[model samples]
Target: MHAFVHEGNELIYKNLNDPVIEKGKVIIALRAAGLNHRDLNIPSRRGENSIPLVLGSDGAGVIEQVGEGVKELTIGDEVIINPGLGWEKNSDAPPKGFEILGMPDNGTFAEKIVIDAKQVEKKPDHLNWDEAGVLALPALTGYRTLFTKAQVKKGDTIFIPGAGSGVATYLIQFAKAAGAKVIVTSRSKEKLGKAKEIGADLAIDTHEDWESLLRNETIDIVIDSVGRATFNRSLSVLKKGGKMITFGSTTDDEITINIRQFFYGQYQLFGSTMGSTEEFKEMLDFISKHQIKPVVDHVFPLNNTQAAFDYLRAGKQFGKVAISINR
Candidate 1:
């Protein structure tokens, strides 16, 4: 099998031994894989002694070989891999053993992968191979953020900063489907326009004064991923006691906030990551119910995996960037 691997500070396309099926697992003939910001961080986290690792998180494929004890799935079934591992049911937090796919575990960047059957779900019928490939990670993150953590409800106004991400696009679609009013912010004018076309009721330029433009509106929830760069500004627009859910910190991890102001405002802040298996199922169902399709900005062939990573790192994508494997 050919895979995109990270070894000693470099990413290379190379051949690897095909994964063998294990009990309760299935070998998937990967059709497509998705790129995420996490994929960019994997190479930096590797130590000098670290083994070469396949890097990818989201993927859609067909079950080619189902191992012993796996009964619910069979060969030829089309499915998407749930990147989240260890955490099974819905809970306040993932278990201590929780880890995402890729990194320490070889992931879906290859033509084939073996994953626990429990991690594979039927690909939503409404989605194509590209859409299904990119759907799992971001959609699950957005679902848990909007529905579980923030408990967003109908008629509520939801504010999303960094609107160009895959998760942000999902948040917009999910929030709108739930009957909430959606507002998004993006530095790119083109992204702001795309956000509105998808379902955002309002799109604001990140360069403008956010608090000033939103003074008349009441934000019940703020879904943010920009981290230190936009954290304070995101809070400034939220109504008192509004919920703020964060899944990633693309800008910077460290940020100092005024404790007094935070407490005084009575805001609710929550941290979220890739969701559990149960939430993954719910996310799939939600998208299926709404007939929602993921926004795929570009697709690259398997051999061009490095270029896909470069495109994502440049922040040029409006939504998800996918790798076509079996295609």
Candidate 2:
């Protein structure tokens, strides 16, 4: 088997021994894999003596082998891999021993990967391999953030900054499907236009004065992932008593807020990350019901995964970037 691995401060495409099937797990011959910003950070996180690890979180593939004690799944089932591990049900936060895929465990970057059968869900019929492959991690994050945390409802006005990310795109689609009025911001005019095409009611340039431009708009919820760079501006546009949910801090994490103003507004703020298994199932059902397909920005062959990482790092994508493995 071949995989893109992080070894001694660099990523290399190389051959690796095939993963052995374990009890309660299944080996999937991956057809496609999705690229996330975290994939670019893994190499830096590893120490000089760290072992080589496969690099991917989102994947879609066919079941090639089923291990003992796994009864619900069978060979040849097309499935999407859930990257979240150990948190089984909906909760305020992930439980202890929780972790994401693609790090300690071998992930979906290779032609074959062995994962717990519970982590595999049937791929929605409406999605192709690429769409299904890129759908799990980001979609789950968006679902938990918008519906579970914010409790967004019909007619609510939602503001999303940094509209070009995979999670942001899913947030736009999910909010719109639930009858919310969606607004997005991006420094790039091209990304703003794409957001409008995908159901955002308004797309604004990030450089603009957000408070002045949205003075009349009642932003019921602000879903922020860009963090320090856009946090204050996003909060300024929200109506009193509104909600603000954050899942990622792409720019910088630390930010100082006005404690008095925050308390005076009676605003609700929540932090979220990758969702639980129940939420992942609910998200699949939701997208299936809405017939929503993931927005795939580009597809690269498995061996060219380094290039895919480069594309994502340069902030050149408007949606999820994918890697074609067996396909």
Where is model 1 more than 4 Å wrong at Cα?
A: none
lDDT score for residue 218 of model 1: 93
Give the per-residue lDDT of model 1 (tens digit) for 187-265: 8999999999999999999999998899999999999899999999999999988898898999889988998999999
Residue 121 lDDT in candidate 1: 91
Which lDDT value does model 1 have at 52? 81
**Residue 146 of model 1: what lDDT?**
91
Each prediction's total of clashing residue pairs, residues at least 3 apart in sequence or on different chains, is 0, 0
TM-score of every model versus the real structure: 0.98, 0.99
Q: Name the 10 consecutive residues with the lowest summed lDDT in model 1.
A: 43-52
Error of 1 at 76 (Å): 0.5
Could you give me the TM-score of model 2 versus the true structure? 0.99
